[model samples]
Target: MPWQKTFTLGNKRKGCHLITNEVVNAIQDGLQNVPIGILHLFIQHTSASLTVNENCDPDVRSDMDMALDTIVPESLEWTHVDEGPDDSVSHTKASLIGSSISIPISNGRLNLGTWQGMPPPTVATGGARSRNIQASI
Candidate 1:
C-alpha cells in the first residue's frame, strides 16, 4: 500500500537550510508501519528548490549561495521583473536545482548517506515564506 501526506513547512531564510529532521519528524508516524518503500518529497514553489548534499558543513551552504548568485547574476536582462530583480533569477536557479527528491525508507528511517542531506535552496524572494511539502510513502 502507498501512503501520502502533505504538510507545510514554516518560513526559511534566503538560503539553503537543512530540512532532513523536519521531513523525518513530519512523516515519522507513517513510516513506522512501512518497513520498505520509497519516500518522495515535492516542494510546491517555483522560486525555491530542493537538493541533497553535504550536511556536516555550513560553509557548503553559503558557498553554494555565492556560486548560484554568481551563476545567475540578478543584473542580467530579464523581462519578468514585474516582481523584482530576484524573481527571474529565482526561477532560473530553481529550475537548475530542481524541486523534488526521492529517498529510500528502511526500518522506519530515511536511508540517507552519513554526510548527505536535503536542503531547500531558497533564492530571490525575501521575508517569511512557507513551503508546501508533500510526502508519499
Candidate 2:
C-alpha cells in the first residue's frame, strides 16, 4: 500500500530550516511495517528550503545558518527587490538549498545515522512561519 502525509512546521527564519526528529518520527509512524519502498519528502515553497543536517549539536545548525547568510547576504545587489531586501536572498538560498529530498525505506524504517536528523525549516528574520512538508511512502 502507498501512503502520503503532510507535516506542518513552525520555522523561525525565512531561510533553510532543518527539520527535527519529530518530523522523521511522523514519517516513520506513517510508514511503519510497510516493507521496502521509496520515501519522498518535498517542501512546498520557493522562499524556503529543506535539508538533512547533523542534529547532534545545536551549534552546528547555528554555524550552518550563519554560513549561508554570509554566502548569500541580504544586502547583495539584487534586482528582485520588489518584495523586500530578503526576498531575493530568500529565493537564492532556496535555489541553493533545494526544495526536496528522497530516501529509501527498509524494514519499515528510515536509514539515518545516529547523529543525523531532519533540518528544521527556517526563515530569514527568525520569525514565526509555517512550512509544509509532504511525505510519500
Model 1 CA deviation exceeding 4 Å by range: none
Please write out the lDDT profile of model 1 over residues 1-137, one tens digit for every residue: 88889987877867888888888888887788778889999988888888999999999999988888899888898778666668888888999999899999998888999999888876437455788888999
> What local distance difference test score does each model get?
0.84, 0.73
Q: For model 2, how does the per-residue alpha-carbon lDDT over 22-119 read when each residue is reduced to its tens digit?
A: 67677767778978888888878777777777878778887877888898887778888775677777777778888887777788877767777777
After best superposition, candidate 2 residue 72: deviation in angstroms?
0.5
| TM-score between candidate 1 and the true structure | 0.93
In model 2, what is the error at residue 3, expressed in angstroms?
1.2
Clashes of 2: 15
Task: List where candidate 2 sits over 4 angstroms from the true fold.
Answer: 14-18, 120-126
